[model samples]
Target: MNLFPDAVEELRLRTREFIRTTVIPNEPAPGERLNPAVRTELRAAAKAAGVFAPHVAKEFGGQGLDIAHWSPVFQEAGYSIIGAVALNCMAPDEGNMHMLELIATPAQVERYLRPLAAGEVRSCFGMTEPHPGAGSDPDALRTTARKVAGGWMIDGEKRFISGAAGAGFCIVMARNDAEDDHLAGATMLLVDMDNPGVRIGREIHAIDRAIDGGHPHVHFEGCFVPDDAVLGKPGEGFRYAQARLAPARLTHCMRWLGLARRAHDIALDRTERRELFGSPMRELGIAQNMLAESVIDIETSDAIITKTAALLAIGERAGSSLSSVAKVHVSDAVFRVIDRSIQLCGGDGVTDRLPLAGYLNEVRPFRIYDGANETHKWAIARRASSNRRREVEQGEPYRADVDAPR
Candidate 1:
């Protein structure tokens, strides 16, 4: 069942208006540089319009819209590459806010979550490590937090950390050597980005052009945090990260779905007008096939995301199986749609004349981040096999036909 209320349609209309008038119009040109001050002003304006942070709860000064309701709104925001930035619901920050709200202590909330929720401060989640470390395999976390005095001493390096440059704080993941199991040994520490021991190594210029804070290489050289800096339980870092990723990836899919839609629309407009071989592009059979395939991909991606969102809203962790399906399907689907759009736009698509090229570049990483598609596939297959084995042991009919094609 969907989670959107009957009033959601009205809300969606208002959201569309806000996105069109306030967000899209304010986005920087393709070649234009990012201006933090201008972004801040746009965020303030979005906050005033009552459309900021749709995914966050009301207690955090957000609209408190649930997944179903938020899906359309976020999709609308995705139309412009900078739409989420203007609304203050962009990545790293949005996911960080959710984690802090769920696990941060009262004092920690006041110190970090409050400013973060209010968009007064920004934060990043530091988990990705350099090669031979925690990249996709989180169990390979090399960062360590050792017990020392009244708190812990954190020392390690984090690579590809988003929002670190201008972030006020970071939710740092480190291995707790005290734990017997390395997976359970992980601990999340809230560290001030400006901590003396916390060094900003280098700014990585990612393919995504609209990212507010450049992804930074972060070094934690004996960064000490008090006992209170621990988020949730001491050794629940992996669990907390898993929980955060489930919804975070879904949100990404939702936003990127919108981006794909925008590309598709742009392509359609071009196809209807541009002529090739003495006929409009839209009259070509290949053009029609591409458009048709895009529609199917986008609609299917929407359905899968909506179903997963409903499961999440009811407090059921759909886990890696469903999430993996959504991730792989959506990632591939959106990429294909964007690719087709670029093809339809011809040389203009590759050029900076429109947002298509940037959209394609930004979505390229979806298959890699959160979790690699190949990894997710293996996990999904293993789980499915185990479930089938259990069913066979219990002498239950497998009913493979129900899920398989004729």
Candidate 2:
């Protein structure tokens, strides 16, 4: 039997259909960016289909689906490159929206969350920065936020910020000069992108072109943001980031999982039709082995994502631990699946004749984003060691309980 409830199942099917039909048809041509007009049209179509922003609250014009219900729906929407775009579930807007809902004041929600959920504008999360700053290590954050009368002055440079180019505003992470501890001083602020002192550099061309507003560098020089723009409390940016990233990491897995599945489907279709050595490629022993490995990878990734999604839904103690594991495993597994599929498809895979080419570029960067797999692996190891030590001291059976790393 299917794991999802009937309503979730139905929503999943509808989302799949919407992606296969509406979103895929309007996807940008090879090497082309999605134009504004097409984006508007897609948003309108998704709204009409009642699938826009499925993860946001119903009061804010979204379906208000929880994390568990969102898993299948997001995967289905991920079938096409533009699927999440049509539904307005694409990040960093998706992640930003989630954060705002959890912590923003009602007025803040009205100003930012509502418009964002409605797909009226986009947003970015500013945390990553150039070398010598907070690229992988958040403690290395150099951006400073100093309190001023009636406002705050934010100063720093952020690089490789996704969705920053065209975003209306950004949830900026900066160090609070008031606090002595760098980590404790970090804060989140909502700054309008158009502020006089906020300068957005040209988009940084990246391997992945699927995300709108290509990752860009931003400079905040004496950018004055009102006191009301602080997200949550002044010193809780890292905490809030952790809350945002856990779910965001899962959603990224869900989307890439769908694309990886699609890659395999393309390869399978090619194998069935192409003749090699007087037999269909699918009949070859080597081809079968590749296909089997891909199947296994996809199945494993799906199982982990599903189980993790369920755990997250129920707020299980092991949920965060599982999410980190899922993020690392699924990201790598999906990449392998796409790679094998590309090999299986031969020339067609590397070409635009199939989706594998773009998918490779799209999935490659995932290994580095969210939290790097290396970093996650390090956290996982530490957690395991700590858990083992505690269990041994208590004379209990060996058990590991780990939470998501901040």
Best by lDDT: 2
lDDT of 2 at 219: 96
For 5-81, candidate 2 gives per-residue lDDT tens digits of 88778878878888888888888887777878998998998889888899998999998898877888988888888
Which stretches of model 1 miss by more than 4 angstroms?
Answer: 1-3, 31-33, 179-184, 397-406
**Residues forming the 10-long window of minimal summed lDDT in candidate 1:** 176-185
Number of the top TM-score candidate:
2
Global lDDT of each candidate = 0.85, 0.89
Report model 2's TM-score to 2 decimal places.
0.95
Give the clashing pairs for model 1: none
lDDT of 2: 0.89
Model 1 lDDT tens row, 250-349: 8889889989999999999999999999998999999999999999999999989888877877777664358788998999999999999999999999
